[model samples]
Target: MRLKVFEFDISNSVLINTQTQTQHHLTRTEAQVLEQLANHPNQVMSKGQLSCAGSQQAVMSESAVAKAIFTLRKYFGEPYIDLIETLPKKGYRLNISTPPPEWQQQLAQRKKLIILASCMMLIAAITLITAMHQYIWFKTAESPVRESRVVTLNNHQQIELIWLQSPKKSSQQVSNMEQKIITAFNLCPIVKWRDVYLAFSNDMQVLNISMQGYSSNGELLVRNIKTSDFSLQPNFISPNWLQEVSLCD
Candidate 1:
């Protein structure tokens, strides 16, 4: 079901800022967290409830669940900090008022449908589609804000820099080049960091990066930077946006 978490729209596996209207991807478990909180709006969802969102990461570890919430807060920034409330040992809840009568009926239907869908594939498909509408019944709701839309990448971003010197190069040189980019960012362990998007632009003379870093002191800084910052040039095809490359090896 979809509902407004502050100015952001909470849809399953996705969060859209109503004003900007840009979609944000949610991990399977994070989606589960929002789903449960939404299911019992204004009511506490015990840690156990949030942890058992029932995705591949079923029964998420406490730390994992915490991380998901951290990510959520970081993305949304400060204005709606109280969108999710914590009740000590009780659990976390969305600080929304009770939904309307029709919403009550829809919730009932969702429960029934969940019980009826026997196939795993069909269930996944439905969950994906279920995000379309949420019938939250509340009056004097916050009006939508207007802001420039920021696009979200479809693929998981793992690194910060891209090379654009030449499309034909050596494998070792390419690997080394990627390492240099990854190492350039002085990422701190205490801060929340995400690799937004890295790509070559301007006739392969510069690299463009859109990234966000949330400091431990609760400062969020975003930069859309283009730089000819690299000192190394490697041969080989350039990396595709959001596809290819596994740095774990």
Candidate 2:
């Protein structure tokens, strides 16, 4: 590995100055220790870790690591000797002046790619959130508002009605009409009908009535009641109104 002016031949235990072509042979222990320090350039490694890296045994004393560092410094000589720095009560660090040029370039490229990928992910997330918000708003604008109520008839039959809100109809008037319809349903027997959906015109007149349920043979059925099909008089409901709205018939 090349570090500044020196080329460390870790496999052959040799260190050579590229400028002067001066070569220095190193011990196996010294080469292992140097390999560890060069691999982690500018980082501290404890004496015990360095010692284990060089020694063949399971454990080696810190003195062996210290001796290797001293020998390596003597070989490095004047200006380059201080490359290995010793910290008080801490550990040793190989203070590489500058990392290898190719390595530095690779690091820069990796960092740029990471930043670009993060920006793309952030943009995609924002776009998805905005699209979902627009979809929800569009659906809300397209669908009409409805008011739902559950009513129990005089005959103790329970039914749920979902009515579309009308611009001209007051809530109180709608409630009165809904109660009248519920009472009229009791005037005739209905089977297999429970949910009703009612629509109203802009002028507050009834538009349509749709009821849904399963038939006697377990088939799904929809019964529709039109405004012209039933009569709602000022003082009374027509006798045939219940028959007109009956699901069974």
Structural similarity to truth (TM-score) of each candidate: 0.36, 0.40
lDDT of 2 by residue, 166-185 (tens): 67666776677677677667
RMSD of each: 39.3, 10.4
Q: Where in model 1 is the C-alpha error above 4 Å?
A: 5-12, 54-58, 99-249
Runs of candidate 2 exceeding 4 Å displacement: 1-101, 120-156, 164-168, 189-192, 201-206, 213-220, 226-248
Please give the lDDT score at residue 89 for candidate 1. 80
| Number of backbone-clashing residue pairs for each candidate, in the order shown | 6, 0
Would you list the C-alpha lDDT of every candidate in the order shown? 0.58, 0.76
